[model samples]
Target: MSRHNIPDALWQRLEPLVCLPRKDPRGRPAKDARLMFNGVLWILRTGAPWRDLPAEFGPW
Candidate 1:
């Protein structure tokens, strides 16, 4: 309300989307999606093998 750079209509349009659920309901997230993706991406980026991942986070 105090004159920010972002437009009011954009805020209104994007507001509801902020509350959407991000992960599956059944199991614990184990890790947040973005972080998990980044870790997997790091592994792929570095060409690391699957056996290197931590116990709970691997082969699920």
Candidate 2:
């Protein structure tokens, strides 16, 4: 996890709140909610555009 990323305790709390991703017959496999949520958190925390998200976070 990144330095500014959500803590384990908070993540544990959020895990139950986050909806499980549905399987899309015609789409690629679903992404982990933790990773995607962290990506969103990074954008919100840094005020950066989705396209400008860091490489470490994977494709934008």
Candidate 3:
């Protein structure tokens, strides 16, 4: 995992809290919650703008 990623132990606790569906019945499928969470953490940790989020974490 990258530095921005949540550790496996922490993710196990967080995974249950994320309630988003993998597939959206009305539109595009939902993005991976773990990845999105990591992206958000990266921004918060780095104090960077959303536009600067790396591609590995998905779109900003």
Best by lDDT: 3
For residues 1-60, write the lDDT of model 2, one tens digit per residue: 679578999999999778555666687663677777888889999998899988877799
lDDT of 1 by residue, 12-38 (tens): 665466445757689664444433444
Ranking by TM-score: 3, 2, 1
Stretches of candidate 2 off by over 4 Å are 21-29
TM of each candidate vs. truth: 0.36, 0.74, 0.77
- lDDT by residue (1-60, candidate 3, tens digit) is 777788999999998888545564787654687888888888989999999999998887
List pairs with backbone clashes in candidate 3. none
lDDT of 3 at 35: 88
Q: Each candidate's root-mean-square deviation in Å?
A: 11.2, 2.1, 2.4
Query: Please, what's the RMSD in Å of model 3?
Result: 2.4
TM-score of candidate 1 on Cα atoms, chains taken together: 0.36
Point out the worst 10-residue segment of candidate 3 by lDDT.
19-28
- By summed lDDT, which 10 consecutive residues of candidate 1 come out lowest? 1-10
